[model samples]
Target chain A: MAESMTFLDHFEIWLRAYLILSLFSFLYKDNRFYKLSEHVFAGLSAGYYVGLIWQTVIVQQLINPMFDEGEWVLIIPGMLGVLMFARLVPKWSWVSRVSLAFVIGNTAGIYLMNALHGLIFKQLYATMGSISNSNGFAGVLLALVVVVGVISTLVYFYFSKEHKGVVGVTAKVGIWFIMIAFGAHFGFTVMGRISLLIGRAEFLFYEWGGSLGQIF
Target chain B: MRNTLPVIIAFLAGIAMVISFFFNPERTVLGTFQENLLQWVTIVGGFTLVLGVFSIVRVNARAVSRRSDGWFYKLATVISVFAMAIPSIMPTSANSAFGKVFYSIFPISWAGAFGTGPDSIYDWLFNYVDSPMMETMFATLAFYIASAAYRAFRARSAEETLLLITACLVMLWRVPIGEALLRSIDVRIPDYINMFVMNGFNLSVQRGIIIGAALGMASMSLRILLGIERTYMGKG
Candidate 1:
């Protein structure tokens, strides 16, 4: 709690309280207050980012090099960057595809090998190592549970063949694993939201209210 | 020419990138080309943000000009955009014009009051306006999601019953209240159950999903490279 309150502190607290209540208004029903806050938030965020990007990126990275240091080689990509604006002009829009294709192709190419190594190989290796490290009957049981869950879950998502009989049974088992995972995710998400709610409530009840109390 | 040229460009770029990653030796021209392309892509990405801002302005401006439903909201949006931008363009000190304007209007200060610098207005709006709104919006989602889960989480079959039981156990194991409730019944629980059953099971299943998704991504990337996925080039 801030004891020696300035007018700015009170002003900020009031602004925050109004925004919080305005957003919560949507829980009851969508209204103009919420709409106003939502739009203002969106605009402020986009505008703030524009400012940040200009300072950190455009000035430091692009402009400083071209004008101050005279690295004219940067102009090729700079030209490519300008071509992105061609989308606004329908006739010249195809020029933008060169830029987009370069991005997509490069990103896809980079991630292909990266994902294969990171996700597939590493995960498989870890699972196998875990199974190997397990000891005793209980450890074996746990290992079995993991193996079955993974295999069945993979089978459940296999879209090529129609699920029936043995395949159907395996997929059915897979659904249980998937549902449980979903429920766990749901629980975690709820807790995360509740934690944020508590933080806001605490600020409203203690800090904001306490600051106001000091003035009176 | 428009369609084919871009596709060819994509194929060449993708192939060069992939080949450079595996086959290009250190200090080779191919490696240098790969590095330069990566930098160029990042610069181009920044330009895309400009395109994004332009689109937002165009759309909101139209909504305001047309006097469409909730046109005032759009007006507010347009106004805030410029309002936020103005402060950042000027020096952010209490002595600076932008800072002076905010400080005189608000005139409130305490420990670490932020309206003293070039970023003063932007910081004020972000902390006071955006932070509260964004947090509360996400917090509100908790109630709706819980409601949705309650309605949809029905045990309709044997598999579903297994799901329900596992879910309940995992959820219970995760929270203090759930642990306290279990402890009250004189049934002592070990961390092993949480470790082996909940975490182990969840990790294995998630790994399966990760592997599947990785395979899908690789295949999709291949498609994009080969021009099978032409949706990015539009005509979709």
Candidate 2:
């Protein structure tokens, strides 16, 4: 397996190792190497996104159907799409507003209904259902915690109600819940970072260091 | 005419969209209208992306021409953009020599993960270069977070102490080592505690925040529909 490896194969793995190390160098201090890598990444991302947008959207969705398939009715939307470029012309900038208005209105309208049904009502139903369906003592205990946690967390965000007496105590409980939740999120993030580190280590030892590892 | 017209259009479009969503899964007249409107938005969104690419080119070109502080990097950026984009613009047939070469160079397993065709130069650049750089950039955040945690996680008060303890337990519970350590002690700690705290309490709190944010979204949408929030319409 080692003898069959080509120069290009070795070069690729080593280069990847070098780049990974260069990126890790930022943890020590931001240097010229890190800056180069960062700029390269930014440029590549912009280019990649442009290519992606063109392939998935413009040529496939717009040009293919409109020009090739002869969808004449699509001319209205096609014209609207072209108007987005009006922003490039100083005198015709106002023409872009028509497109922007449509985009924003449609987005806001879709999200409004989605957030209501998908997030608010669905979550409310799930929370209520959990309490009734809870099986054992532990399950019952968890249901209670969930109920209290939700109520208190909501109370903490209540701005108009002056936090005093019952509200004050509930808000205090809410803060505790929030802190614990934040802690769990942080723990998960730490695990994610560790996993990335492990991946880099695996590459260095297994793929890049394969020949070296075999030698040792 | 410029300002008032857009606002009116926004209001009409917004109301039509909401009315359509109320129609649910089945095909109604309004639902059909909404679907068409959505398709139009998708097409328009593509143009905005091209606009984005132009903006990047314009900015970098100016920086290069004017000999800005990091003009060398900006030049590099511009060069890299064209380098990645040009090769990607060429369509490669699956059965071609280039396709076979790519298949041998990049295994199907890796290519599949990256969601690219065999001969896609875009896929090659993304897999070998872009993903590593982006991952390392974000990985740097982990180090910074660790340092910050060390400084801020001091158990100076009761609340702070509780936070510190919870953070430690939560972190420990995620790994096999933590469970092993507990097992070694001959003390059986129920896994339910971890699940109850994280999944139940933590999730409930998140739901609360989500519901609150949804309410805020609805309110803002209403304001925008009513023309009360004209900031999106741009400067006066």
**For candidate 1, lDDT tens digit of each residue in B24-106?**
54678787787777777788778888788778878999999999998999989888887776555543345545457756766
| Candidate 2, B146-236: lDDT as tens digits | 8888787788876666667777777777788986775566555427537676877788899899989998998888877777877876654
Model 2 Cα interface RMS deviation (Å): 2.0
Runs off by more than 4 Å, candidate 1: B23-31, B89-119, B149-152, B183-190
Of the true contacts between chains A and B, what fraction does model 1 have? 0.59
Question: lDDT of all predictions, in order shown?
Answer: 0.77, 0.77
Best by DockQ: 2
lDDT per residue as tens, model 2, A166-213: 999999999888887877777788888878777777777788778555
The candidate 2 chain A region of ten consecutive residues with least summed lDDT is A207-216
Best by lDDT: 2
